[model samples]
Structure formats: C-alpha cells, structure tokens
Target: MHMDIEKLVESGSIVNELDYERAMVADRKLRLLAKTNTHFKHLRNKLRNLIVEYEKRVWSNEDAVDAELLAQSDRAQLIIEKERMFLEKRKKIIQARLKDFSLTQAELGLLLGHKSKTHMSELINGIKPFTLQDLVIISKIFKLDIDSLVPKYLSIEKIDRISAVIEEINNPKLSKIKPTLLSAS
Candidate 1:
C-alpha cells in the first residue's frame, strides 16, 4: 500500500492494480460477512439461552458467565447494524450524485480507471464495494465534497451548499450572466 501511494504520487494518473485487486477481495469478504452475520447472531442468542438455563439449575450460586458474552454479542450486533446502514446510505448517495453529474457507467468507469464498465456497474450496484481510493478519485472527478459521500458525516448546511453548486453548474444562464458596471452618481 505504501508503494502504491508512492506510485500514485509519482505518476499522478496511474492507479496501482494490486491495490485495487486487494480492495475487491476485501469488499467481497465484507459482503459475505454481512450476509452471514445473522447466523452468528442466532448462534449467540442460542448460546446465551443455554447458559441462562444451565445457570438456573446446576450453577444457581455461580456468577453470570453469559453476561460478558451477551454484552459482547450486543456490541457486535450494533456494529453490524451500523455498518449495514452506512453501506445502504452510501449507495444511495453515490447513485444520486452520479445522476446529478449526468455520467454514464462507461464514463464513470474511465474516470475511476476501470477498463470495463461491468466493474463500474458492480461497484454502483453494491456488488463490488468502493474503496477509499475509489471514493477519493470519484469525489475529485465529480467535484463533490467528501463529507457529502458519507450520510453520517454530511450536514444540512453542506447539503444546501452542494445543491447550490449543482444548480450553478447545471444552469448555463447563471454562468453566462455578466457583471453590470454601475456609474457613481
């Protein structure tokens, strides 16, 4: 990753293929984990229940061993929920920004340094995740503030500012307006 950063700094336009490949693998693993997390949750709940029942019978005087485990499980569940929500929110924001910019999948693919539009489509559809590097490049190409890409980090003021900028960009008449010279009376 350090070498990749150096390459990016030196070339300015080149992306390290290895870094992208690693990100793709990481993305797939995350997606799989998300899909299977419910199973883990179910197991945790079952284990907690069994521990509680055992404690009620043979270990009535014993300390609650499942308390720590249950707390950890709850924390894990919360983290998973937060991550899922973040991903969903990010996907919507990216889709909206893409529409606002009027960029096609192929065009976006080129901008993101992907040779195939399929890869771009996958990224867009949440099949392939967007890495931090991808987000930086996309933000630069789209002239978007990085905060606007993440729903949690975005504020109402920032959204208003982004909207104003988009309006200015889309309205040719606004750009064409010339400043009138005022004569002092």
Candidate 2:
C-alpha cells in the first residue's frame, strides 16, 4: 500500500485507481489470512486433544510422541505469531503517518480539549487508543478517513474494524445521548 501511495505521490497527487479496486489486494490477503488462521486454530485444537489423549494412552512412552505433530504445532504457532507481528507493523505505519501530520503533543492536547500533552502523546503513539471523538477530530484535521490514512498493506479486517469504530462513534444514538448527559449533569 505504501508503495502504491508513494508511486501515486511521485507521479502526481491523484490516485488514478479506484479505492475499492486498489483495496482488492488487501481484501484478498485478509481473506486468505482469515481462512488460514481459522484452519490453524482448528488444527491447533485437534492437536491439543491428540496430545492430551496420547499422554493418557502412552504416559510412560516418551518415544511414542509424534515429533511430526509437534513440528506442525510449532509451525501453526509461528504462523499466528507472524500474523500478529504483521498487524503490529501495520499499526506502526499508521501511527507514523499520524505523527507526520500531527501537531505537537501540546498542540494536540489543546485541540482535543485536554490539559496534558502526556495523554495526547499516548493516543498518537498508540500506547492508548483514541476515543471516537478523537478519531473524528483527527480524521477531519487530516482530511482523511482512518481507513484511507492507514497503511495499504494493513488487512482489510483491521481497516473494517477502524471504520466500524468510527461509525459507532458517529451513531446518532450515542451522539444524542452525550448531549442529554451533559444537559442532565
């Protein structure tokens, strides 16, 4: 995704490709991950059951344990770990972009109606998650949707999660409820 964006920026500021089409690769990759992860989980559960039952049957036979099974379990565990690492890397990329356009911590605090830069930095650094209001404010300030601003290689699942969070924040019921609470208090 970064490569595409870099190419676009280098060529000119316009994205000649449609976003949905551009997102297709990410979507496919995410779908593959979903399928593989699901299979890995299912296999892991089966492996655990096998190990437990094997232990019951061959408690004294150390050599009876299947090394191949253990190897497969390790591979599955490694895959899951790699997926998690990839997600973290994607998050970092999004964070860096946020910082690139962000005001200083003090400036962000003022914009977000906070009294402390420490809290604001936490949000920007992903040490603390942003509230919906903060996400909205950041999106507007950057002229970007959280999804679009995020790294292109990021899984569509993560993008959808971010979009869902933003949508929930903008929901009319929550928006209305907040004002009512302020009025009542």
Candidate 3:
C-alpha cells in the first residue's frame, strides 16, 4: 500500500478524489515537518559559535586543551559544514522559485524589508542564515501555499510513514464505510 502511494506520487497521477486528497495531505505534512525542524537551524548556529570559541581557545593555549577537545571541535565544525551545504541546496531551490516568478534580488530585498540587494545576496549565498521570520516573509511575498522555500529533507523512514498514512486514508474499504443518513418520514 505504501509503495502504491509512492508510485502514484512519483508518477504524478491524479486519478481520483482520494488520490488528490492523499497528495494534498502528504504535502501538508511535509511542510509542517519542515517548519517543525527549526531547531536544527538553531542548533547549526550554536554549533558554529562553539566551533569559533573552541578555535580561539586552542589558538590562545594549545597546550591546555587535550586531543579529545580538538577532535570534538573538528566534529562540530564538520557538522556545521554539512548543514551549510544542505542550506545551500535549499537556497538554490528558493532562487529557482524566485526566478520562476521573475523576481530580482533588489525586488526581493525590498519585499523582505532589507535595505539593499547585498543583504539579499548574503542570504542567498548562505553567509547569513535565514530565520523563520524570513521564510514567512518570502512565502507571503511569493504567494507560496506551503513552505516551499525551505527544502523538506525526509528520511526513508519518514517517507514510508507518510506513504502509509496516505494509503490508509485512501483505502477503498474505509472509503466505502460511509455514514448512513436516517430519514424521518
């Protein structure tokens, strides 16, 4: 059943009302999940700060810190790098969407309440991480229905769960079990 729904979504089919509803629900779930993962964004910023602090400490007194601390700092830096890469991909998607709407950086900056295009470029280049408020403003400006500006990174298990939910909702047996109306004569 999960596979069927996945196949349907992948095939881009709108066979019936159930299929359409399932697709809509899945998309909504994805958007909600993306929004809920705001913690990751915060965590990335915290990690970046820790990395900088650790680097400064090591530089100030290399002999005081042990190898383990250095190794841990390296790990934190690696995680921050990976998160930046993920954000870069999301930025590209947002840029593509902006292009689709024929929007320029200057225009987007104005819409987002920025002073100039340079600020928008910084956000686009991943120099400045986007806050949730930024995403909301972009969504409003572009008339985006879902959190399409932020990329949804779903795990395999998450995909399976979503597919299962879609299948269960669209199951024919469930659809056939309609409530009967009682008529008073």
Candidate 4:
C-alpha cells in the first residue's frame, strides 16, 4: 500500500487514531512478508509523526494560543489538529447511524461516489477528507444537517485569512457578518 507522502505533509493532510491503527496493521502485514519493507515503513512513520504532532497540540494553554505567534509549520499542524477534532464528531455520528440504518460501508461508500471501500474508510476515519458535496449528500440521505455532518471550526490560518481579507475589503457591511466568519472565536 502506497501512502500519499505529499498529501500527508500538506495543510490538508488528515491523520487520526484510525489512520494510526491502519498504519500499524499495515506495518505488521508488511513485516510478516519483509521486515525491511521501505514503503510500509515510510507510511507508518509519517502517520506516527502526524499523530505525535496532533497530540502535542493539546496544551493547557490552548485557549491562549495566538496564530500570529506560531511558525508556519506549527500553524499548519494546528490546522490539522483542528480539522481532526471536528471530523471526529461527524465520524462518530455517521458510524452510529450506519449501524442504526443497517447500512454497510460499501453501500455508503458507493453513495459517496467512492467505489473502493478502503477509500471510503479513509474518509470515514479522517485519514482523508470528505468533500463538501459528499457530506451534503450524506446529510440529505441521512436526514442530518450539513452542519451536523460538519460542525463548524476554523483553523487559525483561515481565521487570519478572513480577518485580513475583510480588513482589505474595508466594507462596513462585512462587520455584520463578522460573527459568522469567526464562529469558532
């Protein structure tokens, strides 16, 4: 199994507890065939790194964190953590509903336009993101709000970006929607 290294490193990268378990399972499977399998080793290592990064972010002072003070890479990792936290909530809801509705992963996967159950698993587990359209489809079919499918949270970078753009636009009407823009704040 090949890991998307570039994706794993990007701000968009998704790594979660399930991804770690999958990596460990893959590592074990690969090791049984070849102890020194480079591909599995690399994939496992990257997943470990991401999990470590996420775990380190849970400081007691999290509320005091300011985006401006973080280095670019730290900011990116913060985004990863934020995304993972929000996705975990949606994942829990979806998984429970799947069983309640007597639905198989493959069936839901197909509905989400994912022909491969593994890919669907990735999306479900937060190892990969679900597209907005995919989430909307799930919401419609499952009688869930799109917000419930993805409760709102903004990464620090996005918050800063919106703040900057609003400042640049200099539109007084933008002030009316400021609360919506920084909902997480």
Candidate 5:
C-alpha cells in the first residue's frame, strides 16, 4: 500500500507494524532532509515523539495478549513477519548488488518503471509493494533465486481457501495431506 506519509504524520496514529514502519521511514527521511530544510525538523520531532509514545503504549499493553490468543497471533504474526523478512532480505541483496556494480538508483528506477527516486526508495525499503514483473526483473538482473524473493508462508485466509478446495476435489492423496497442511490454520 502507498501510505499517505504526510497524512500519517498529521493524523498521529500508528495502529500496526506497517504503520509504525512507514512512520519510522518518514521520520528518518525527514531527519536527513532537515539538514538542508529547516521545515522538516519540526515534522521529524513530531514523528519521533509519536514513535516513543507508541513504544510506551505497547509496553503497557503486554498483559492484554493472553494465552488463548497466543497461538493464533503467533501463527499470524510469524507469517506476516516472515514476509517482511523476505522483503528485507531482497532489499539488502539488491542494495548490495547496486553498490557492487556501481549502479545508480536512477538506472534501477527507470528499469523498474519507478521514475521517482523517492518511490523507488520506498519500494526498496518494503514500504510499498512491487509488481510481479518488477520482482521478475530484480530476480533476473540480480541473480537472486525466485523462491527466496517471494513469500512462502500461506496466510490464514489462503490456508482456509486451499482447505476448502482440497475438500471439494476429494482426491485421495490431497485428502490425506489436507489436514496436515492446514492444521496450523
């Protein structure tokens, strides 16, 4: 999702991990820009304060998550975190390759159809989604394995959908594996 970064700043809310991450990126960008632009200093401080408040709230709510919800939350969070980790790995590898090859962000941006360096940076930082075609290009150019570049974890919704399909098909082999595959879901 292309988060409205300034809107996020003005609203002063960080509900989830993605929101927190985007806000952090925005805060960092503002900090860097604040060196040249005096206007960004106030914005950076505001976001930094928000992040601190968010951390405090999270610490205070530790007891809210009980044992009953732990399994489900763990499953969901692991899937989500795994996806993020995969993207982070991709970003690092891509960055390393760019530096090693003496490639400019502009050149990569043009190839990926993101003319704006800012948008490219967002994509590189996993703040935005990349199209499948873009991933394909990255894979080909960077020699990164396709499997390592994408999410392998099935979301709960996807697990449920596949379970339903397996039930509908009723193939003996699939039937035998369905319960095992979807047990976590």
Candidate 6:
C-alpha cells in the first residue's frame, strides 16, 4: 500500500511520461475533492436526521411547541446553508484544478465521463450533488487512493483565522465593546 502511494506521488517524475505528471496531480486533486465531498455528505446526513427528528416531534403534537426544537431546526438550517457554501467552494477548487492543468471544462467533463458540458459545469460549480460513487469514479480517473486524501484535505490551519473573524462578527456585544477607546466609531 505504501509502495502504491509512493508510486502515485512519484508518477510525475517517471521517465518520458508527461501524462504521468498530469495523472499524479489529477489524482491528488480528485482525492482532495472526494474527501471534501465525504465530509459534506456525512454532515448533510446528520443534519437531515436531526431535522427529521425535529419534524417528527412537531408532527406528533401540534401544541408541543418546544422552543429547543425550534432552535435546533434553526441550527440545522444554518448547517445546511454552510454546507452548501462549502460545496460551492469545493467546486471552485475543482474548476481551478482543471484550469491549472490547462484543460477546458468540457474536456475535463469528458475525462470524467460526463457528456454534457452544462452538467459537468454544474458539478464543477457544486450546483449539483454527486454520489459517492461518482467521487470514486473521479478518483479512478486520477489513479489515487481515496483513503490517503482525507487528512490533507481536512487539515486547514487558516480556518482558525476565518472562525475567529466569524465569531467576532456574530457577537453583537463584542462588537459594541470597542477594542480601543481612541478608535473612531
């Protein structure tokens, strides 16, 4: 297994084979995308189940009106929204990867066995949801091991900066408490 991974990473350097280089990079990109998709799918399912449970409660008793249930529903909605945004981001990354390889989106779509450029574009744009099987197909085309992709895709140190900014933005009280008294309002 380790040998296969090394082979993939070293594919770019194989003698007289530029295609190997392309394959290696594509493999890396596809693996990253598949990992991201898996994360999104798992989160989506969890949110879906929570929403279902909440709906069941509401349906069972019209007068129940659990404030906590309502709050959970709101949280579920936010999670879905955030996941949608994340999907879009992932699509953009995929598109960018195609661009980096100087491949037309249509060409990439073809490579991925997608005939319709529009549909392919939608996939690349994260406007369409892909089955896990589709992600596997993508990895096959790239010749990558799906298991090796997750850690690299999920480890993002910069997320802390973004989270800190969002935390400040969401807290009105914190916003009201100016960091510096001398700063103009």
Estimate the TM-score of every prediction: 0.41, 0.31, 0.44, 0.57, 0.58, 0.38
Error of model 4, residue 177, in angstroms:
5.7
Q: Encode model 4's per-residue lDDT on 135-175: one tens digit a residue.
A: 89999888887777764666554666887888889899985
Best by lDDT: 5
**Ranked candidates, highest lDDT first:** 5, 4, 3, 1, 6, 2
Clashes of each: 0, 0, 0, 0, 0, 0
lDDT of each: 0.49, 0.44, 0.50, 0.60, 0.67, 0.45
User: Could you arrange the candidates by TM-score from highest to lowest?
Assistant: 5, 4, 3, 1, 6, 2
The C-alpha stretches of model 1 lying farther than 4 A from their native spots are 1-65, 125-127, 150-185
lDDT for each residue of candidate 5 in 112-145, tens digit (9 for 90 to 100) = 8889876676567564567778888978888888
Query: Candidate 1 lDDT, tens digit per residue, 39-107?
Result: 323433443344444435533555544675455444434433444455567667777777998977778
Q: Per-residue lDDT for 10-109 in model 3, tens only?
A: 4544443233333333343334333545532443344344434434545458686778655544543433444345655667777887899898877877
Tell me the spans in candidate 3 whose CA falls farther than 4 Å from its real position: 1-57, 60-62, 140-185
Model 6: per-residue lDDT, tens digit, 16-129? 112222233334334444465663344334433443443454545867767865654454343334444455555665566666678787886777678886557446544344
Best by TM-score: 5
Compared to the true structure, candidate 6 yields what TM-score? 0.38
Q: Specify the poorest-scoring 10-residue window by lDDT in model 4.
A: 17-26
Q: How displaced is residue 98 in candidate 5, in Å?
A: 0.7
What tens-digit string does per-residue lDDT give for candidate 2 at 52-140?
44345544476765776455444334333433344466456445655886646667667778777645543443323456686567567
Error of 3 at 152 (Å): 9.7
TM-score of 5: 0.58
What local lDDT does model 6 show for residue 88? 53
Candidate 5 at residue 137, lDDT? 90
lDDT of 2: 0.44
